[model samples]
Target chain A: QQPVQSPQAVILREGEDAVINCSSSKALYSVHWYRQKHGEAPVFLMILLKGGEQKGHEKISASFNEKKQQSSLYLTASQLSYSGTYFCGTLGGSNYKLTFGKGTLLTVNP
Target chain B: DAGITQSPRHKVTETGTPVTLRCHQTENHRYMYWYRQDPGHGLRLIHYSYGVKDTDKGEVSDGYSVSRSKTEDFLLTLESATSSQTSVYFCAITGDRGNTEAFFGQGTRLTVV
Candidate 1:
């Protein structure tokens, strides 16, 4: 099943903070985060497998709530490089195949 | 980079013509996938192969077929291309099944005119 991301698009200033939420209708075994720039392939950011778990990468971090079938990605003190579409991939159902969400477009301006 | 390469980074084909996209990998990963990215659909899976000679359909498999005859190569074929098939296709590879990083290729921008 595909996850739903909130705030299809957001604008932020440099050094600002933002949060992207990913929700699913099915039980998830793992959740993944990826960032893609304009005309570029998506790059992996982080993965969360356990409930109530929080993981960070540089100024970006994410939390997974298995019970609620939701995950939130937090970008703190955003930078110009953080402007891109953020996607959340979930592995559920009977197989490990990941279904990604529509994605959240984050634009950080100077 | 994960040593994944997609051929024909850009292609423009006529409708009703058959088209095939190639994906090659040097990482020798066991799992490979084909996905198309659109404006509102994000990334929709076309097909995937877990091993040589083994393939399965994805959510958007209509008009598309896949074959994996070798460990490093996966091919996606469109029997009769249509304008709806115009999208950027990406090939991905991953070694592990759970909590592992998946690497993506540069992507092939295909236009069916």
Candidate 2:
């Protein structure tokens, strides 16, 4: 099943912080975070394993909760470069394909 | 970043015509995938191949077929193009499942008229 993303869209000023949440209905093995700028392909951010470990890249971080079948991405001290659509790819229930959430549109203004 | 390249970066076709998109990777990754990105749906996997001649259907594989005859190439074909299939198609690769990060190609903008 496709994962669910909260706060379909969010606007933040530079230096502000924002959080994007993703949830799945099935037992998840991992959660992958990716950022896609307009007119470009999605770029890998970080991946959270099943043990609920937290991972970070620069000011971006994410946590995966296998038991709860959910994950959350936190972007702190946002910058204009952070403006993009964030997607969470999920692997769950012994599924071969990684499913993605609808995505959260983030706009960071100067 | 994985040296993955997709062919026919942009295309336009009439409805009911056949369309094929090619994905070539120089990384020799163990996995390759075809995904379609549409507004509000993010990217949905259409098909994936684990090894040469070994393929699997994804969440949204209807009307699409895939083949991986060579390790460096994976192809996605639409038997009959439809307007709903018009979207930016991306090819992704990963050395391992869930253990490694996946890299995507520039993408192919496909339009069905």
Candidate 3:
């Protein structure tokens, strides 16, 4: 099944912070985060393996809670370049397929 | 940037016609995947291959078929294109499971009339 993402869309001002959440009903072995611009393919941002770990990239950070089967992407001091759609991909069990969330559209204005 | 390339970046074909999208990877990754992106749906996996001749269906694999005859190439074919199949297709390659990031191609935008 596909994961669920909260806050379908968010608009933020420069230097503001926002959070996008993803939850899956099935047990997940890993959670992957990606950002896609208009009319472009999704680009990999980070991957959080099992064990409920957290990973960071500059002002963007993500946390995976294995127990809850949920993950959250945090954007701090947002930049205009961060204006795009964010998606969370989850892998579970023997499934090699990465089920993605409906996606969260983030618009950061300068 | 992982030497992944997708052919026919943009294509337009009539319904009921067969369309094939090819993905070539120079990185020699063992795992390759095909996904489609739509308006509301982020990216849905169509098919994936772990090795040559080893493939598996994804959630949205009904109308789409895929093949991986070589380590460096994977192909997605639409047996009979439909208007609903008109979307952007992406090809991705990963070196290993979990913990690793997959690199995506520019994508192929296919339109069916």
Candidate 4:
């Protein structure tokens, strides 16, 4: 099954912070994150495989809670360039397919 | 920029006609996938291949077919396109398992009238 993302949409100003959460009912082996600009393909952000592993890319960071079957992405000091839709893809058990979350649209303005 | 490229970046076709989207990868990854993105549904997998001639259907595979006769190429075909099939299609490649991060192509926007 596909993972569920919270806060369908969010708005932020420059230097503001926001969090996007993804949750799945089944245990996850890994969670992958990506960002898509308008009219473009999604770009890979980061992947969290190990339990409790956190990765960062510039002002973006993400944490995975294996026990909770959930992951959270943090956007710190958001910038106008960060305005895009974020999606989380999850793989569980022996499933070879990566199920994607609904997605969260984030708009950052000056 | 995983050396992945999709052909026919944009296409408009008539309903009931057959269309094919091609994805080429230079990295020679073992796993290749085809996914379609819609307004609120995000991206949904259509089909994938673990190796040459080995393929499996995904959640939204109806009306869609995929072929991977070689490791470096994966093709998605719409046999009798419909208006509902109009969307952006992405091709991705992964390493050993599905848990690994996938590299995506720019995508092809297909419009069926």
Candidate 5:
């Protein structure tokens, strides 16, 4: 099943902070975060594994709670470039398939 | 950026017609996925392929079919297109077993009239 993301949309002023949360009902092996700009492809941000290990782009960071089957993306000192739709993808037990959440639209105004 | 290319970046087809979108990757990633992005639905997986000739249906597989004849090519076909099927299609690839990040193609905007 697809994961659920909270706050369908949010508006932020430059340098403000925002957090996007993703929750999954089933156990997850890994959680991935990606950002998509308008009319562009989704770009990888970071990934959190079951063991609390995180690997991803240096500019973005996230946290994964294996016990709770949840993940949160932290955006600090947001900039206009941070404006976009953020999606969280989850990977279950064995397959390479990744399912994504509905997405959170974040608009950063200058 | 990952050597992934999607053909016919934009297409407009009539209802009940057959349309095919092609995804070609030079990365030779073992896993290839087809997803459709709608306004509120986000990106919904339509189908996926693990290897050549090894494909499986995803959550929203109805009215769609897929084929992977070679390691570098994966194709998604709409047997009979409909207005409801109009959306942006993305083709993504991952080299490892869910450990590495997926590389996505630019995407194909398909419109059914």
Candidate 6:
């Protein structure tokens, strides 16, 4: 099943912060995050393992909660380059197939 | 970039026609995936292959079939296209399942009329 993402859309100033949450009904073994710009491919961000560890990419970071099957992406001091659609993908059970959330549109203005 | 390429970046086909999208990778990854991107649906998995001749259905596998005859290529086919299948298709590759980052192709925009 596809994961659910909160705050379908968010607008932020260049120096603001934002959070995008993803919740899955099934137990997740790992969570993957990607950012896609307009008319471009989705770029890999960071992957959180099953240990509930936190991972970071530059100023962006994410935390995974194994017990709740949820993950959140945090963007601090958002930059104009951070403006794009963010998708959270979940891998459950032993299946390698990744299921992604509908996505959260993040717009960072100057 | 992970050396992934998707053919026919833009395509328009009539309803009930068959269409095939090709994904070629030079990274020699062990896993390949097909996904469709819709306005509000985000990116939904259609099918994936673990290795040559080893394929499996995904969340939205209906009306779609996949074949991997070689390690470098994975093909997604729509046996009979429909208007509902019109969406941007992407092909991704990963070195490991859920253990590594996935690299996506440029994407193919398919329009069914």
The model with the greatest TM-score is: 5
lDDT of 4 by residue, A1-110 (tens): 67899889999999999999999998888889999999887888888885555443666788889899999999998889999999999877675777788799999989
lDDT of 3 by residue, B43-94 (tens): 8888999899999998799999998889999999999999999999999888
What tens-digit string does per-residue lDDT give for candidate 3 at A12-84? 9999999999999999999999999998778888889897564536668888888999999989989999999
Residues A3-106 of candidate 5 have per-residue lDDT tens digits of 99988999999999999999999889999999999999999999898887889877667889988999999999998999999999998886767889999999
- Model 2 interface DockQ: 0.80
How do the residues A1-107 of candidate 2 rate in per-residue lDDT, one tens digit apiece? 68999989999999999999999888888889999999999899998988756454766888777788888999999999999999999876475577788899999
| Top-DockQ candidate index | 6
Candidate 4 local lDDT, B1-113, one digit each (tens)? 67999998999999999999999999989888899999899888899888999999887999999999899999999999999999999998988674557888999999999
Docking class of 5: high
lDDT per residue (tens digit) for residues B1-113 in model 2: 57999999999999999999999999989889999999878898889998999999998999999999999999999999999999999999988777678899999999999
How displaced is residue A2 in candidate 5, in Å? 1.4
Candidate 6 per-residue C-alpha lDDT over B23-110 given as tens digits, one digit per residue, 9 for 90 to 100: 9999999899999999999999999998999999899999999999999999999999999999999999988678888999999999
Off by over 4 Å in 2: A53-56
- List clashing residue pairs in candidate 1: none
- Tens-place lDDT digits, model 6, residues A1-102: 899999899999999999999999999989999999999999989999997564548678888989999999999989999999999999887777888999
- Each model's number of backbone clashes? 0, 0, 0, 0, 0, 0
Q: Which fraction of the native contacts appears in each prediction?
A: 0.64, 0.78, 0.84, 0.70, 0.70, 0.92
Residue A105 error for model 1, in Å? 0.6
**B-chain TM-score, candidate 1:** 0.98
TM-score of each: 0.95, 0.96, 0.96, 0.95, 0.97, 0.97
What candidate 3 keeps of the native contacts, as a fraction, is: 0.84
TM-score of predicted chain A against the true chain A, for each candidate: 0.93, 0.94, 0.94, 0.93, 0.96, 0.95
Error of 5 at A62 (Å): 0.9
Worst 10 residues of 5 chain B by lDDT: B94-103
lDDT score, residue B98, model 3? 59
Model 2 vs. true fold: TM? 0.96
